[model samples]
Target: MSTSLPSAEPTPSPSRPALRKILHIAFWGVDAQTLARDIQAHALTQPGWTERLHITAHDLPHADCLEAMQTWLTSELQTSGTRPHLSLLVPSGAAQNANAGELQLRNALISAGVSFQVLYGATSEERIRNTTNAIALTAKAILPSSERACFVVSDIAKPINPRMRSWNCEKCSDPECEHRLFTGLLPA
Candidate 1:
């Protein structure tokens, strides 16, 4: 009998790493941060999630304090080239003066030109919809406008006031603008 030749396997080729989209979510409170960590841990342990989009996750851990979160948010806003997407996970009030924490969060975010809304739902679909919307909102997608109109300003110009010390504003908005011209708001 003739000896059969052993089959050869093709060598693997090097390829570029898979692109990953980082969704940086800033927790509004300690409880929220803890819950997020727990969720991440559980998801990683679950086989189903491991098979999904998430492979590995890493971020600078918040120092179990609100100051850390605020600082991180501020720093990211200052440096992130593209419009930074902020996902604020606000937890229910457990402490007696939880409102204080809420207020601090609001102050930090608002001062940085970030707007937010609280979402609560009774059903999974509702929750998902709310969450999708919240993310979209954070990304500055103009949706659910009271006037139900969409506007795009192809020509954007910087207006200068020669009279009053050359008024300078980081951003400008005009709700009355019928065209709904995008006035440097919600770039994300």
Candidate 2:
């Protein structure tokens, strides 16, 4: 009798899909105080969302911008009677190693007694998209689906090059850009 050959075992594949990073954005108007008040009021009268508000400002440089963000948090404290948890995501600057800036943002939040998280080195166009995606996913977990979200697209002046021109220009010509899909997803 001939000996039979042994069979090889099959390798198993991953059970779940890898999670994509999406930006969870909360858009506030120019008036942070008003926006904060409205959000806090909702938390007080309504039970759908946490009084906690998360903010992500892309490429912001002004003291006023910081103030506005702070205003939003302060309003939540005054109206809802508690400080909201905070997280910040910042893009890497020209130097590529922009973790310093991200640290500054985190430190600012900590100084204010707010818990925060910061993401850095997202300077490239591709990286920016990834970081934003990460934010979206994070926001979805904390906020409700019905909540309106917003993001600030800062200066496109820096990293001025042919490649960037192509990227931005493609958005105008291409219909598949995330901006288009994101806006379309919003309920009227």
Candidate 3:
């Protein structure tokens, strides 16, 4: 008669919970309102894990876009009260089809001390290449098949200002620096 007892099976460990969800944002010089709407729409439309929506303004085009973004950021920052992980879609090159509005957006962001990472958008190839890694990290990467939510600031209404052309204008002045650089032109 065998006296040896059957070896006991080892207890299995519980699986770990999934990490915080991340949403991938691809900017093509889109304004903040449109971007926000797109992100919200994606959250509603896409099927998969749920994660909070956010944005990182990379090299953008247009002052208006920045302004709109600032409005969104102000709300988000106030609510969240901290820097959130985000990605920015920027033109691949200065000579590309990038708009002046996009350039203004980037410049304003830099001046405001906002931070973001650049994802190339010069060509389909480059945009694809830059986005691959970001998309992979997300639980669900989404894009509108026909109309992407991203819209250039130039497409939005501009904030009109009369003294934007004047360097001495308070609108153009920078409190942080002796020399005032054009933060961005008021919507116009």
Candidate 4:
């Protein structure tokens, strides 16, 4: 009689798909300390968010913003242990094609195996409103159908005024209100 070999059991695959994590990182033209403080404040307000969500706030020097961003992103990917989606919030004006900085950033991210999207909006009220719309649309377009969230990296120094916040808001009745007149534009 010939000896028979023992049968091996098949390895089981994952039953459910993993939840998609989105990390929004904002790069403000502020000091690193201030950025860290702001991020901490946000984290404190939202309980358990820091653990579950991937929100990051950082400073980006105007001189070499793209290089800085690329380096930071690569570092984050290596350290975070999660392949969360990425979105960059840069001033609309700073995204000019003269230097091709945005293009370089995009290429770097792709080569590093990171999925990313770039959304631009002026700090001004009108432009910010448009940017919000763009952000939403882009999120819908780029995010996979599975569970996902958006992370925003921006240079928004202060909260936007209520009337000017929403894109559909009617013109402010009080013309004298400085907030109403303020466009929230950041320095180029």
Clashes of each: 1, 12, 13, 11
RMSD to truth, every model: 18.0, 21.5, 19.5, 15.7
- What does candidate 2's lDDT look like per residue over 18-132, in tens digits? 3321322322112222323333343333232232233322232333345554554454345433343334333333323434434454444556676544332323443334434
- In terms of lDDT, which candidate is strongest? 4
Question: Once superposed on the true structure, which residue ranges of model 2 sit more than 4 Å away at CA?
Answer: 1-86, 91-104, 121-123, 145-188
Q: Which 10-residue window in model 4 sums to the lowest lDDT? A: 1-10
Model 1 lDDT, full chain set: 0.38
Q: Where is model 1 more than 4 Å wrong at Cα?
A: 1-13, 41-73, 76-84, 92-96, 119-188
* Model 2 error, position 128 (Å): 2.8
Specify the highest-TM-score model's number. 1
lDDT of 4: 0.42
lDDT of 1 by residue, 50-119 (tens): 2221111113333445676577657655544333244443434332334555556656667667764443
Better candidate by TM-score, 3 or 4: 4
The whole-model C-alpha lDDT of candidate 3 against the native structure comes to: 0.39
Error of 1 at 179 (Å): 29
Against the hidden reference, what TM-scores do the models get? 0.38, 0.29, 0.35, 0.36
Order of quality (lDDT):
4, 3, 1, 2
- The lDDT values for all models are 0.38, 0.37, 0.39, 0.42
- Considering TM-score, where higher is better, how would the candidates rank from best to worst? 1, 4, 3, 2
